[model samples]
Target: MGEFELIRRYFAPMAKATKPALDGSGLLLGVGDDCAIQRVPANQDLVFSVDTLVEGVHFPLGYCPRFLGWRALAVAVSDLAAMGAQPVCFTLALTLPAADEAWLEGFAAGLAEAGQQFGIVLAGGDTTRGPLTLSLQVHGTVPQGQALRRDGAREGDLVCVSGQLGDAGAALEFLYDTAPATDAASLLQRYHCPQPRLELGIALRSMASAAIDISDGLHADLLHILRASGVGATIDLAALPLSPALRRIKGGAAAGFALQSGDDYELCVTVPEQRWAAASRELQQQLTVIGQVQQEPGLRLNADAGMVYSQRPGFDHFSIT
Candidate 1:
């Protein structure tokens, strides 16, 4: 098929079927127009998430196309996971220097695999010629009044995090500087293919008052929650979770990277003190308590003289760096 024809046949048809928005019956409007239409069911909340991956910025050249496709979708979906929302659908926009049949095939296959895995359909998107960039906007839904928000945290709530941190950052370090170790395979995988903690988010909806995804490092990500919730936190420096691989090379430094390097995609959540035990037990496989919410309105790290780690900010797309 010719390029435009291929898009109309395969991509356009899919978009028409997936409607980005919804109808009166709560059915989603996925793919037919310039924008997607979707429905938020009665008594349900809608979650919207968008992420972009640039060739030179987000990934290095020569990175596998299949993995890039998967990572693009996964990164967007991680926001839904942070909100305790059910995967619904997504729209993709691609900018490329040129189209290659083999590359498209591989990319589509990877996107298809992730779509099926996450129960999200590719509803719509645009393709253009430019520097390689992939952007995805995803929609997820949660029961009415059940989606978690960054502003719902309360003072004295327990602060929690899902899964190990720093692995992705450590992996990036290796990806750019040196060869990855045999054990570092998992870290590299974590960097490339982070699994959004959707299951845990669903489980925590009722228990967690506030939540945010760890995309721009824990310190910055958590600040969103703190600012919104009007609270502060005291994280134990000794308690930051590091993968076994990360611990081997740079011990505490890895933990620091985990705290500030960004792109972890783990969920940082806050639950009332009373709900801690139950939340912990229910999400034991996916969560761990890192600290507690403070009545004070400032963030602090575990250190002598009450050190604050928010000094070194996380990645900002607009930063002058």
Candidate 2:
């Protein structure tokens, strides 16, 4: 079959498998359109997020198909996690070089496994022949008025992060430069198997007014929230969390990696001081307060003199390649 034709038949149809059970009689529109339409459920705010992963850019070419699928969905869902929304459904669009049955099966299985873990369903998507890219649009639902945004952080709100950071970026370096060591395996897993903190997100729905998932380096990702809210942050270099595995491998560099490396897929949130204890208690499942939002409007790294540094500014799609 032709490339686009194959996509229309197989790839496009895959997206609709879950809609029958997810949407009521009002699906509005599915695939094969310029845009999709759906009725926003009563008492719910529709949350929208998109993420894209390239084959070589995001994952190594030898990366496992199942892990790739898992990571792809997790990356998109991470955005929802940052928004403090409950994942509802998602659509995938994949562009591949060829139709390899084994690869497709493994990829689909991995995506399904992630869906099961997160209580989300595949709604719809599209596929086409190209270099190789996977883009997912994840839809989440929150209380009618409580979907967290990146613009609501108030001065004095605490900056919090879910999970340790930099392991993923460190993994990338390990893949190319270092021999297979104990830390290499763990770091690679961090890059391939991202866990989106959906539970913590739902719990912080009302407490955190601003949030964003760490995709780019922490410095760059936090700048997103800071820019949106017209605020700044003072991230305690000492408080940044580092996985024990990473610390063993990179030592003091782990903190810098945690701050500047991306692909953590962890949620960074800002909660008011009054709600800190309650929010922290609830999100103890997967969160930590890393810093504080500042009245000043610029990014600052609080640390001893001249010790702070970032290896790379952040992941920049346009500039990287």
| Candidate 2 backbone collisions, by pair | 15-124
Instruction: Compose the digit string of candidate 1's lDDT tens values, residues 1-321.
Output: 555765675455444434334446333555555665666777787788888889878888977788887888888999999889999888888887887777877777677777778878887788888989988999888998888889988888888898888788878766754565676777888887878888888998888999999988888899999999888999876687777887786654656667887778899999887777665555665677789898788788875343223468778878955
- Candidate 1 has its poorest 10 consecutive residues by lDDT at 18-27
Q: What is the lDDT of residue 64 in candidate 1?
A: 79
Q: What is the TM-score of each predicted model, taking all chains together?
A: 0.89, 0.87
For 1-321, candidate 2 gives per-residue lDDT tens digits of 665565564445444544533536224566667776665666788888888888887788867899988999898888888877877778888888888778887888788788778766666677777888998989887878788888999899988888898899888777664457787888988887899988888888878878888888789888889999999989888788889998888776778768888888888888898887665544654667778998899789877554446646666779966
TM-score of 2: 0.87
**Model 2: ten consecutive residues of lowest lDDT:** 18-27
How many residue pairs in model 2 have overlapping backbones? 1
Leading candidate by TM-score:
1
